[model samples]
Structure formats: structure tokens, C-alpha cells
Target: MNTKQKVKYKKNSKKKMNWITDHLFLFPTILFFLIFILYPILYNIMLSFKKMDVSNFMTGGVWAGLANYQAIFSDPLLYKALLNSFIFTFACIVIEFIIGFALALLFRQKFPGVNFMRGLILVVWMLPSVVVGVLYKWIMAGDSGVLNFVLTQVGLIEENILWVSSEQFALIAVTAANIWHGIPFYMIILLGGLSTLPRDLYEAAKIDGANGWKSFLKITLPLMKPTVLVLLMLGLINSFKVFDLIYVMTGGGPLDATTVIPYYAYKLSFLQFNFGEGGAVSGIMLILVIILAIVYLKLMQKEEAN
Candidate 1:
């Protein structure tokens, strides 16, 4: 080969080798995702369309073709699960956000023992959901619970209330526990966002005769929008997937009052050995979460464009 041709061939070979090496480095991560995430998702989607029970799961059961979906749609339990999931998710996020934002604002100011208090508050959030569930379950026990004892002593109520065992209070009890466990996460995230705000903006506002509330309304909220939106989306997804706490505390009892989507899916798949129906329920949840995720992405894109 001519000298120039040989040089070009060498360059092309080097480029090919580099490309191969780069892809080789990425292969492990790609393989992991395919095996762990993508495969399970596709498999579950397929399972949702099949008539699979514990006996037929290993044999690649009969193709029911939307029968599972039809059954799930017609089941009143599905609607109840959806409602509980929505109520739990909405209540947790709203209460957690409000309390967390307030805590963030409070901790933003310089004070003695503030760092210590913040760390202490985070200890609650750091605890495992199972542990929190057990702890609250004990505290909210009807006859001998601390909550009932305190309320009675304080004259709030003359009789012990069944917090976890009663349908009316089971959802509220779980939500309150979730809120306590979630608030520190929101507080830490909002505090980080607050730290990024320009101090000079506050100074300027103050010079313009803006009060604390006015400055917060005009500057803090606007500047924190992106952070707030992301946190809210994450909180929504996390809250919707809650299972361990409610399962530990209520076991979806008191007439399925606390049976959210995840728990319902678990009940169908594991408890009833109805994998097809369970897969259908899970598929529905995945679709709903994906829709929210798409909305979140669109909002982020719009914010970036602006």
C-alpha cells in the first residue's frame, strides 16, 4: 500500500479499536440494566397477558390476551386500591412538603444547637420503614397504646380509639407515620435549594422595603421552583410505592382500608398465587408512574426553555 493509504488504514483501525474499547467498558452496566430492569419489566408485561398461577408460572402459561386486564378493571378492589394509593400519596407529600419547608426555613437562620436539632430530626427519617411501622403500631395500639393513654389523660377523648384496627383511622395512622418518615428528606432537599439562593436578592428586597413574607413569595418560591418540582415528583413516586410500613402496621386490614396498589399486587401474586392478576395490577401502577414521570420531564423541559 502507498504511504498515505497505509496511514489512513492505521487511523481507521485505531478509531475502531477505541470504539470497541469504549463499548466494552459500558457493557457491564448495559448488561446489568438489561438483566435486572428491562427483562423483569418486559417479562411482567408478558405475564400480565397470560393466565398464570403458581402451578403454571414455570411452564409459560396459557395466553389469556387481555383477560387479566379485563378482570382487574372490573374488580372493585382495584378502584379501592387506587383511591387508597392516591389518598396516601397526596397526604404524605402535602404534609411532608409543608412541614419540611417550614423546617428548612427555620433551620436556615443561625441559632444555637440548630445543626444538632437538624441531625436529630434526620434520625427519624433514616430509620427503616419497617421499624417505624412497628414503633407506631405499638404507640397507636388501642387499649395500652401511648397515644390513647396520653389523649385520655389530656381529656382529648374519654375512650381509647382504635387507630390501626379501625377502617376510619387506619389510613390516617399510616399516612401520619409516612409523613414523619418523609419530612426530613424534604427538609434536607429544600435546605440545599435554599442555600443556593443569592443572598444579595434578599438584601435588595429588604432595601426595597420588602418584608420576610414578601421576599419569600417573590424570590424564594420562584427560584426554588425547579428544586420543588423535582422533590415533589420524587415524593409522589415514593409515597405511591409504600408497602412495608402499611403491611407491618395494618396488613391491609380493617377491611382493606390501607391496601394500596403495591400491597394489592402483593396480595394477588404472593398471597393468592394469582401471578397474572398481580402482574396486571403492577402494570397499571407502572403506567401511572410513567405518566407522572413524563409530566415531570415536560415541566423540566419547559423550565429549561424559559
Candidate 2:
């Protein structure tokens, strides 16, 4: 070959090699994403359109063509589950944010044992969801529960309250436990955000006669908006997908009072052996989470632009 042609051939070969090497490095991650995430999502979507029970799950199930969606949409239990999920998510996020913000503020002050206490607060968050659920279950139990004993001794209650087993209180019980487990997470995130604030702003505010509350409203919140938005989105997603804790605590029991979407999907899939309906529930949840994620991304982009 001519010299120029040979040089061009060498450059093309080098480009090809570089491309191959780059892709080779990415192959493992791509493979895992496809296998563990994408494949299951696509499979579940397919299953949601089919009529599948335990017997037909192994084979390709018969296509029912939106029957699963229709069934779930028409079911009153589905509505109940949706409502419960909304309530649980709302309560968890609001309460956790408030308590966490307060705790973050408290820990922001320099004091003796503050670091130790901050580390200790993470114990609740570090515990496994199932462990937290089981622990709370015992603590909230009716007959010999610590909560009941304490409340009664303090003259707050005349009788032992069935926290987990009572239909009226089962959702609240699960929510309370979830709130306790989730508070540390919020505290950590908010505290990190709070630490990044400019100390000079507070000093300036003080000099300008802006009181604590006024400074917090005008400076702290506005500066922390992005962090707060991110935390709210994350907390919403996490709260919506709560299953292990609720299952361990109440099993969505006491007449389905705490039957949030995840647990409902679990009950349909495993307990009732109805994979199609369960898949439909999961697909709906997936869509909701995706929408929330998109909103979060958009908000983050807007924040970055600002």
C-alpha cells in the first residue's frame, strides 16, 4: 500500500482498538444492568399483560391483553392500597422532614457529646428494616408491650391499646415505626446540607437585625431548597416502596389497613398466587416512581441552571 494509505489504515485500526477497549471496560456494568434491572422490568411488563398463575408462570402465560390492569383498576382493595400508600408516604416524609430538620438544627450547635450523640442517632437508620420492624412490633404489642405499659403508668391510657392488630391503628403503627426508622436518614442528609450553608450569611442577617426565625426563613430554607427537594423525592420513593418493615410489623393485616402498594403486590403475587395482577401493581408503582424521578431530574436541572 501507499504510505498515506498505510498511515490511514493504522489510524483506523487504532480507533477500532480504542472503541473496543472502552466498550470492554463498560461490558460488565452493561451486562449487569441488562440482566438484573432491564430484563426483569421488561419481563414484568410482559407478565402484566398476561394471565399467569403459579401453574402458568413457568411457561409463557396466555396473553390477556389489559385484563390484569382492568382487574386491578376495578378492585376496591387496589384503591384502598393506593390510599394507604399515599397516606403512609405523606406522613413519613412530612414527619421525618420536620423531626429530622429539628434534629439537624440541634446537632449543628457545638456542645459536649454532640459528636457521640450524632453517631448514636444513626443506630436506628443502620439497623436492618426487618430488625426495626420486629423490634417495633414487640414494643407496640398489645398485652405486654412497652408502649402500653409506659402509657398506662403515665396515666395516658386506661387499657392496653392494640397498636398493630387493631384496624384503626395498624396503619398508624406501621407509619410510626417507619418514621422512627427513617428519621436518622433525613437528619443526616439535612445536617449535611445545613453544614454547607455560608456562615457569613447568618452573621450578615444578625447584623441586619434578622432574628433566628426570619434568618431561617429568608436564608437557610432558600439556600437549602435543592437539598430539600432531593431529600423529599428520595424519601417519597423510599416510603412508597416500603414492604419489609410493614410485612414484618403488621403483615398488612387487621383487615388490610396497612396494605400499601408494595405489600399488596406481594400479597397478590405470593399469597394469592396471582402473578399477573401482582405484575400490574408493580408496573403501576414503577411508572409512579419513574414519573417522580423525572420530576426530580427536572428540578435538579432547573436548580443547576439557577
Candidate 3:
């Protein structure tokens, strides 16, 4: 407790206080996450192992220990829904990327009303899924729908096609609506990535007598790889969790054709009152998303290191 010792103790105390103050700023966020996101996920996992329904949901139920998961595996409907989900996600991602990238490139150039056009396109993306679903549902109606009338006039078919009600086209209709809704998101992300590319590289490429395609293949694609990867990963996760759109558009389909995993879980939980199985489905989806998210993080780390 001499002069030097007293100063040293005072500095240590100040450092301790500073550390506490810094971490206190994170307390609210951490507590919010623990209470909301983490708690619900943990509860869902626990519910999957129990024999609970609306009957015993409030009281909780006896531990069933994998029965729900076993039932999920045994059901043929789950496989059908899973396959449908894969097809829907694949179609939406591919089509949206192509159209969105093209639009992004188009909008990046200076043109009359270019800013206004870009903002207008975002109106579709900003809409709620339910609203988009309803809009498409009407446009795809069987008898007097605009789509049917136009196709008939163009001689694409002799009669109106059953877009939403028919098993053959229900899934396609849902996929098309989703593609339109998601294109703006892809456009904005890819446009941001495009904006960051070095102008010097393009100038250099042009001096080397490289054509537009050549420059794009050589410079643009290579530079945009990280952004493309991240966008695709996000799109896949969002597509997998699609529910509200499907519910509003087709209500899981004419014959389960558009019933993706999320809708399947909802059908089980609310429609059938099988909470255990529904929770199991959610747990499975959560695991799949977590795995993909881990891969996304690893890829990001590698990109940063490079």
C-alpha cells in the first residue's frame, strides 16, 4: 500500500470497471436472444420427444423417446413433400438468379427513369408473401383468369388451364409466384456486388481487345463468386421455410403437391393436432439449416482469408 502499490491497484480497479461497462452493453441483446430464439428452439426439440398433442400440450406429456421421428420417417407423405420442396426451391433459385442478374446488369447502366424503374421493381419484393400469393392465385384461376384468356387468344391451348387446382400445375404455379417475389432480392444483392468491381480491371480488359462476354466471364464472375454463394445460401434457406405463400396460394395443394416441409409441419400441428410430429419436423429442418449455415460461415472465412 505504498505509492507505487497504490497506483497499481487503482489502475487494476479501473480496468475491471471498464471491462464490466463494455460487457454491460451486450447484456440486453444476449438476454433477448436467450429468452426468445434459444428458448423456443430448445422447447421445440424437447417437444419432439414427447407424446403430446392439444390434449396434453398444456400439461406436457410423457417422454416418447424418438417415436415422433420414427413416425416421420415411416410416412410416405413426408418423402413426397420433401421432393416437392426440393423441386420448388431449385426452380425458384435458378429462374430468379437468371432474371435478377439480367435485371441488375440492366439497371446498373445509366438510362432514363432507371432509378424509378429499380424502385418500382422492389415493390414486388417488399410485398408480404400472403398478398403475392393471393394476387397470383387470382391470376391463375381456371375459368376466367387473365392468364388463361391470354393463352387461349395466343393459341397456346384450346382451353383454360387449371393452374392452382390441378395437381400437374399447382406446384409450378406456386414456384412461379415465388420466383417473381424473390427476384428483387437477388437483383439488389448482385447489383451491390457488381457496383464494387474495380473499373480499372474492365478498362484493362477492354484495352486487351476483350469483348463484353469475355470481360464478364473473366472479371465479373470471378469477383462476384462470394456474393453469389451467400445469396444462393440465403435463398435456399428461405425457400425451404416457405409456408405462408403456399398456404395462401394452394393450401398445401390439390394433392400435397406444393406441401413443403414448413407447411407439412403446420398441417401436422394445427390441422391434425399432432404437435409431437410437427415439432419433430421443425427439429429436422432446423438441423438442415444449421448445417448449411455452418458451411456458409466456413466459406466466408475462407474467402476472407484469401
Candidate 4:
């Protein structure tokens, strides 16, 4: 072949090889995703539509249609769990956002220990959530809790309070621990957003006779809207999916005050052997999250368009 023809042939061969390699590289990821994630999701959806439990495992499950869903709505325990889930989610969002924003704002100014403080905060976030739960359970022990000791020394209380044992306080105690552990994550993300903001905007605001609060409201908040929205959506999702902390700290005990939806689904599946009901719960949660995600994206799109 002529040199020009040879070069053209080589280019064509290279393009074809590149296409093949790209497709081939995706095979393992696609295979694992389907096998591990997608397959289980699809299987769970199927199970949700049927009746399967310890009683009918070997004999094949029955078809329940919407009965399981109706049962979910009708069951008082399920409603209680749903309420607790919302409470936990709301508390996490409020507490984490407040603490995180404070830390981000403080750390925006250069200081001697700022980096060290940031690193220490990240350590809390890096610890496995289960480990944090277990550690807090120990710290909140009725007799020897450090919190009780400190409070007593400060004359805040006369005796050790049963933080985890009381039905009235168990959920609040667990939520507090979760807030401590989760605030770091939010702070880091918000700090990144803060760092990216234009200092010139703040400077101009100050030049134009804007005070701190005025500048924050008029410039900082509007500029940070996208980041704030992203954090809120993610924080809500993460809080709803909380399981390990409650399972370890309270075990949904003290009249099930700490039982969130994830823990409830776990109990229905493993503890009660009600696989169908658990699957249904999981499916419902999945649908709800997906709907929220779609709604958030639509809002974001509209905001961006304007």
C-alpha cells in the first residue's frame, strides 16, 4: 500500500481499537453492578409484590398484591417508626447544618490551630459510624458516663441520668451523638464551598456600606445557594438511612422510641423473618428517595435556568 493509504488504514484501526477497548473496559463494572446491586434491587422488588416469610419459605410464597403496603400503613408500629425517622432526620439536618456552618465560617479566617482543628474534626468523620455508636454507648453508660460526671461536677445535675434507658430521652441522646459525628462531614463540604467564594464580592459589599449580616444575606447566601441545596438534600438522605448508630446505641429500645425506618426494615427482615414486609418497606423507601432526588434536581434545574 502507498504511505498515505497505510497511514489512513492505521488511523482507522486505532479508532476501532479505541472503541473496542472502551466497551471492553466497561464489562466488569457492568457485570458486578448488575450482579451485586441491580439484581438484588430487582429481586427485592419482586419479593415486595409477593408474600414470603419463615412460614412459607420452602413451600413457595404467596402473592399479596398491595396487602403488604396496606399493612405497612395500617400498622401502628410502622407509623411510630416513620415518625421517629422524620424526627431523627430533622434533628440531624438542623444540628449538623448549624455546627458545620459555624465551623466553616470560623475556619475561613486564618489561625494557628485552624488546620489542626480541621484535621481533628475529620477524624470523627473518618471513624466507622458503628464504632462511633459503640463508643458513645459506653460513654453514656448510666453509672460512669463522662457526660454525667462532667455535668455533676459543674452542678448541672445531682445524679447520673439514664440517657439510653429512658424512652423519653433515648432518641434524643442517640441523635445528639449522631450530630456530633456528622457535623464534620457537613463542615468539610461547606468549607470547600466557602473557600471557592469570591472575596471581591465581600470587599465590594463592605465598600458599598454593607455590614457583616447584610453582606452575608445579600451576597454570601445567594452565592452559596447551590452548595447549600446540595448539602441539604444529601444530609436529608443520609439521616434517613441511619441504622448502625441507633441499632448499636438504643437497639430501638425503651418502647421503640429510636426505631427509624431502616432499623424497622432490618428488624422485619432478620428478627421477625418477614422478608416480604421488609422488602416492601425497602421498596417504598427507595421510591421515596428517588422521588425526592428527582424533585431536587428539577428545582436545581429551574434555579439554574433563572
Model 3 C-alpha lDDT per residue in residues 1-306, reported as the tens digit of each score:
699999999999999999999889989999999999999999999999998887888888779999999999999989998899899999999999999999989999999999999999999999999999999999999997889999999999998899999999999999999999999999999999999999999999999999999998999998999999999999999888989999999999798988899999999999999999999999999998999999999999998899
**Could you tell me the lDDT of residue 20 within candidate 3?**
100
Better of 2 and 3 by TM-score: 3
Model 1, runs deviating above 4 Å: 1-14
**Displacement of the residue 122 alpha carbon in candidate 4, Å:** 0.6
Clashing pairs in 3: none
Error of 1 at 146 (Å): 1.3
lDDT-wise, the better of 2 and 3 is 2
At residue 217, candidate 3 shows an lDDT of 94
Pairs with backbone N, CA or C atoms under 3 Å apart (clashes), candidate 1: none
TM-score, model 1 to reference: 0.95
Clash pairs (backbone) in predicted model 2: none
List TM-scores for all candidates, in order: 0.95, 0.94, 0.95, 0.94
Each model's total of backbone clashes: 0, 0, 0, 0
Off by over 4 Å in 2: 1-18
lDDT for model 2, please.
Answer: 0.96
Whole-model Cα lDDT per candidate? 0.96, 0.96, 0.94, 0.91
What tens-digit string does per-residue lDDT give for candidate 4 at 176-228?
A: 98998899989999999999999999999899999999988898788888999
